[model samples]
Target: MKDAKLSNVFAYQNITHKDVFLSQKKYLSLFLNTIMNLESLKQLFLYHGCDKIYVKILSANDNSKNQVYLSGSYDVLNIFPISEIVADSSGDWKKERFKASVKFSWITDEGKITDAPNSQFILYPKYPEVRFSGFLQKSHNAPSELMSKRLPGRLLFMSVSNSGKILGYVSSPESEVTQSFNSLKHLEVAGVFKVLELELKINYRELLLKELFRIHSLGWITSKRLHKSGNILPCVSSNCGGYTLEAELGISANGYSEPDYLGYEIKQFKANSFDRIANEVITLMTPEPTGGIYVDKGVGNFIKSYGYEDKSGKEDRLNIGGIHKSGVRQPLTGLTLQLIGFDTETFKIRNASGSISLIDGNGNEASSWSFTSLIKHWNKKHNQACYVPSKSVKVPLQKYLYGNKVLLGNGTDFQLFLKQMLLGNIYYDPGIKMEFVSSSKPVIKRRSQFRIKSGNLTNLYKQSEIVDLLKI
Candidate 1:
């Protein structure tokens, strides 16, 4: 299988101290081969109660010691959780990261499942990369033949389920599965791995579009919310517009970034008019802070330290409301948003211990959201989203009518979110409030919202489009 011309063309430095060279066409061909239909391949994962699937073709250097390289960006961190970054003494290699915790298993062609408890994903933020290892270490019934050595061209299909387990399947060398996947899969990416946005029965995007089209045919729906327990409740408030859309779609409220319907977040925005899908402030995410005074102290203490008194002539009330952008101080809160460990100019994480922090006047950390914490939420909810502009009615028994024209965004990385933050297209607007401030235990409601205008939304995704359900 060695042609000196091809071998010399793609030979890369093999880290295993071996004379092995993989072809440029191996990666190049896989990128362009999009005709392989993988419906059968998808059904296997679906049968295992998995919802999202990602693929990574092994390289000659992708071994246990070297680890499987994930990505240079924070996107893969969104899919697979990483352990806290352990900074070393020297800055030569930058940062070394490990998997937080994961349960990995191998599913055979016969549907047999075996656990690979040692399986872990490591991150090298120096290169700002992630790698895979431990799967073939002391594991039985695992793909030792494919993963144990410096093997190239073996396909790895890893899926994430609602239960948080990462299940995987490796194609046998020269198996028909690899051939079909190479020929028929969509050229989509998920972090370091290629995203398998399959045409399956569940995770397929077109199926969701068709369902939305069905709801579009319904004209309008009564304002109501579907409970996660499958109960229907009257949604008579401003949020009823979003609630009604979820109800019509038969989806239950799954908190932040958890897939709402068909592995996509269902977002309903109150549009002034649907003719152009008017610019509206969309709540991107509401992840709580994972560090600084927010975690060291309490939310009450943090709020008292940084928040301002309510300006609406309301007694015994405090509020923190307004826009907070990177490197800029907000007058009301008296805290500036700062991005640490990241080089916004290069769009890279120069340090793994980086964070989005709110620093107080005296240079104290009021609250900080670590890269590990934010990336988990950023793309999980935003990776794929369907933004539906809606108009609500309260006079006629409360109802919501969605526009036939919908905006569908796919393939986003947390890096895009950060990139937008750098440009001031996205800002942190908190609606935190404390009532009965003088009481023994004052009630506090915290809402940390990162919002963006609908017009600027396209900058966050790799592919975005206005879909007319009627046309479909």
Candidate 2:
């Protein structure tokens, strides 16, 4: 029974009037025989509980010879407990009994079940083959440009290997589709895969510029109207602008998991707004400090040791806000955030200054980071950033002003950024603060920051483009 092919076990028949007899005894016998056959079929297939089923995915181009085994479960009848099938007690067997349907479930390494697998499998009993198909069509609701141009093909199977490599098989002759699957499988596993280049439908830069110009053409849009109408507006707060731009662009505003504003970070600021004066320093990231005197201390303790008084001069308040110039001592901490081991001119990190060292509380220098290491971390988040400038109008009722004239910062120049930092034009200012309410070690709000003057932005970025809001 275990070795029996599905074709040999399941039978299909077409009954005609001649096959039936009106005699009550004969009719009863026929009914009993039909039930017995169904029972036998069920027993043969579910003899081992039917909880575990293995799928063999073969390459159609290779004549179904090369294959990979993927563990899965069939959800037909009462075979799998993931869904239940109930029988009716009304004695009308044909209408009351649960209909048998084909369903398949595959468990991912992350313990997630792929969606709607039952509909994705196209079984060919005559060919004695079950092919998983229609994934590209069924899984994505993307623009046609982003969709595969080739004919929809059968999905072979995909599985994660023991070595953490993703293995996939597709029964398709289209090399492009198969190659795309191969290249994107790793991103798929991480759950952050997105084909933005295709999904965008148009040149991304052109689209963004067009949108920006449309906004600029409006002259001025009231913040009250934007907030009430749920429309896109240039927000005063950088944080608020980040969220508003996402909503305007039809992107989800909730998590860091997905790319922001279609694979680019949208940063809005008033014209001539700098990182320190505006308190809007570009935060590369918020990774925990790796080492130094700060390593042993908790965030609260570290703030207590290094924090200074704000304008109010409150006791035990830590204000990690001050100018950090290369070679020159920092204004607040008296320590320099120098480019020690890197060639300042070439923007390269050298082996001698392999690590950025800082003097600790005990007067011993501790290695903080090497230029090579920092650049790697920075590159991950700074891939593409859009800096926008806005014109602000004071709102008498609100704490912040309304930003109207939103201008685009075409692109960032990493090399210019390094050069600026070396020349004291750009600086690192950690805007961390500790609020001591009842003296239970205080609550800390840490904002790791890197700042540059608003006027010096041209040196760190490419030429600006003005977006006309009215046209969009």
Residue 370's lDDT within candidate 2 is 39
Report how far off residue 345 is in candidate 1 (Å). Answer: 1.4
lDDT of 1 by residue, 265-379 (tens): 8888888887877478888778888888878998888878887888988999888888999889999999999887767667766665678889989999988888777765666
Error of 2 at 375 (Å): 3.2
Q: Per-residue lDDT of 38-83 in model 2, one digit per residue for the tens?
A: 2222222222123122122233332222211121211110111112
* lDDT assessment of candidate 2: 0.40
* Cα-based TM-score, every candidate: 0.79, 0.47
Worst 10 residues of 2 by lDDT: 73-82
- Model 1 error, position 353 (Å): 1.7
- Supply the TM-score for candidate 1: 0.79
Q: Which consecutive 10 residues in model 1 have the weakest lDDT in total?
A: 12-21
Score candidate 2 by TM-score against the native: 0.47
Q: What is the lDDT of every predicted structure here?
A: 0.72, 0.40
What's the number of clashes in each of the models?
10, 18
